[model samples]
Target: MPPLPAIEQPAAVFVARPGTAGRLGQAVSWRQLMVWPRWVTLAGFAIVVGAVWAVVLGVIAGAVLGVFCIVVSTGTALIRRGLTARRIMRGSLTVATPGMGMASRFGSGALDIAQANGITRLFYDRVRGIHVDRDIVVLRYAQLFIGFPRELFPDWAIELIRAHRAASGTTGYSANIPALPPIPPIEQPDVSMVADPGTAVAMARESFRVTLRSVAILSAIFAVLCLFLGRLLSHDHGLAAGLGLAVITTVWLLASAVRGGPKTRAAYQLSMPPGEPLSARFGSEAFEVRTASARIRHPYAAMTSMRAHGPAMVVRSGGIHVYPRELFPENAITHAGMVNKLLAK
Candidate 1:
């Protein structure tokens, strides 16, 4: 097995050269990312547009619109590929770090990768399959393939990844994989974020307000169209048509607020009461939160967006987690550092 290059700090394992994509090693292109997500929105637009058109026009028209829906999204995805590639090529460097995977006696079987956009932490346990080549290596995990170019990606790093993949009940193409180094020292937060009863409720209230602003604006636009149509089709007065829409809009607003406002606030409040402070622990591979209600875990690979909103570090994976900056250590782990450590959408 090939020996790994010298480590600068135990925390970081590998880092590519800067100022060029050739040195960045790994990149997730817009085309690859759009594969599954594009289908979701396309399907939605097709169903909605087709159904509405079918009711108003005819079945044939609805079917045509459904096909048109897919065509538009497909073209958009192709256009985005060039834009995304351009942004990725402008990368600085790619860094590989440790302490963010399945913690083992020898090592945490995780590869924390820094790319053009942000950090991507992949755990060996989650990797279902591996594809290795002379120039590139790709791991199949969670409905997507993450690729690493061997031209810039270190040999030792590749060996380490293949070895871990084999050990984690997965097969690797590499015939001889190197032994992993001992687990490095990891850092975790000792301070906990205590949830004030009022805080959660306030956050939920603000979220609902934001939701309302967007929804209401859209509803108003639709309402105007509805009024115009009603005048032409049903011969109804504009005021009567508008009034009917106003009632329906009111019901929609109430339903939307109820769905995510009160319930979400209650869930947040109950999960982390003052007595049971939420311990937001940072591991090399994942972010975990132990609350009174449940233990929530978010892998670094799954993180989509992160931002510091007001006094909180708001993170979005499949769901959202808001950590109060007043409680979370600011100097040790800066907002920029946190953003840089995870894959951000």
Candidate 2:
């Protein structure tokens, strides 16, 4: 028998640079984004326009308007494409071209990753990359994963490939693939406007209180409607007026008790710097619910008010109620006071 060959294990495994598209392969063009749904939508829009014009004018005028509308639609698509291309060039969007088997750039480019003995097949069209800070990762289109430490394999490898592709100008293997733009930083609150913990808590509480007051005011309008109904029933305007006043008072009392709830629904989660207060936001407005023990913050300003009612923490946004009271700290009175301050403004 011939001498057996010696097999040696390599020190470290590294993926080679991805290859460029060959003469047989074709890159996806900007036009490919427009699909059957787009065509169907366009057709539906045309029919709607045609119907409207026909009702207002005549068949000939309607047909002319519809044609004009369709002709102008292409410009809208072109404008969107221009914006997308600009964003891509600026690294605002990252795209991954998967190894598409027979349709792939090369004959053999498939790869797999394994975790906890489980394996997942990654497709060519799937984009798996990290944002600028390499902190949050967007995977398989729109799914965002944060809090997890940057993965050891995919992000580092993608970055390496991106660097190579960038350096190669427009001629590299992944040249057609533009690097995704870096993720923009999240805006933080301006603390100069905030003097201290009291200010922060007060700002949040007053906001909530004001929201309740507004709801109470709006509920008064309903009372006026009830008074009108009473007049319709009895013809005695005094009775209607009295009923309206009663209804208004009832609504005001209820609104004041609940701090102008039922507010919008909001979910609460805690991050680092343990023991920080709880926060809530109500659509561009922010509030912090503070207790003797801890504070909660609503960074988005989406929560208008938060108060403790019995066992549950009552959060009011606009006029909507949110989240169970049990979710907040146990001291109900303190938290409720904090909420009153937030809504007061």
Candidate 3:
């Protein structure tokens, strides 16, 4: 049998400049609202601001202040979006494939993205998922997210991309984009490895430890501030008791957060039902978690951090996913190196 030719990078593909109104709309639509951390931070901000307002004025004033804060946040987000859009419009944004992976350049800055494996570029694997829409083409690599303008590439380039995706054994469908044509199946690498239940528990514990420490530090700072404020104000007996209660409650909550990690780990174990072992796969484009009855795919971009923790590969993105050395004794080191390399790039 003849060897297949390597897939070379495509030439630079320029994105069409959208009108001012259209650019503004695109900017607003691209907001990171889907990212959980953004929402969590916003909620925290609201709580702190409302509490401060309530203490200064009254309940009604606090409610009004919260509403005003939310409105201001929304407006500020829109303004930032407009600024980003204007920046993109002013710069020359182009996409290219330097090799197997995709690369995009805006003005002087450029982003190079590819899968984790040393042998295969994400574009050739077909196993990694790609989503195409009228406005964007979102490519999922092992460690990065690449969203480029759909109209940036010509029809031929789009067809070539679809061809690669069709060849990959992906079974998903996108409603917003045109349906992809089927292609011959290619052999897929075995990325899935069954993980030890004990490892999962340990990972959960570590995650909780980090969270608890953060909360404890913040709580201590807040308690100190409250005490200082009480001293500054008239040290009434009732006010002192209230401040004492607040400190007690904060300490209690911090303790609970510390204890919650193990409980959460136990809950995860119960949810898994412990019939067969849990298996995880690292594909060209995404990560897959499989159980006896079901499988779930998570894009690599969804993972925020990946690093070597002793003999394990600890990933914290949407949640905690730990790959222990016991499971992949031979490949754990290699996997860690690849992840670190990707992250470094």
lDDT winner among the candidates? 1
Point out where model 1 deviates above 4 Å: 1-27, 30-52, 91-108, 112-121, 128-134, 138-147, 151-311, 315-324, 327-345
- lDDT string for model 2 (35-62, tens) is 4566676666657755655454456645
For model 2, the local distance difference test gives 0.35
Candidate 1's residue-wise lDDT over 206-240, tens digit each?
55555676677857765675455445434434345
Candidate 3 lDDT over 1-345, as tens digits, reads: 112122234234332443423442353346432335655665676567557656655565456545654675577566755664544333212112122232221111112221211111232332244556666665543322345555444554455555555755222222223322111112242444454556556655655656776777767765665455445443553246336635654765676676565555653353244344555555544554443322334445444566665645556543455544343333533554365555333
> Each model's TM-score, in the order given?
0.41, 0.26, 0.36
Which candidate would rank higher by TM-score, 2 or 3?
Answer: 3
State residue 102's C-alpha deviation in candidate 2, in Å.
25
**Count of steric clashes across candidates, in order:** 4, 54, 3
Of candidate 2, the 10-residue stretch with the lowest lDDT total is 100-109
TM-score of predicted structure 2? 0.26
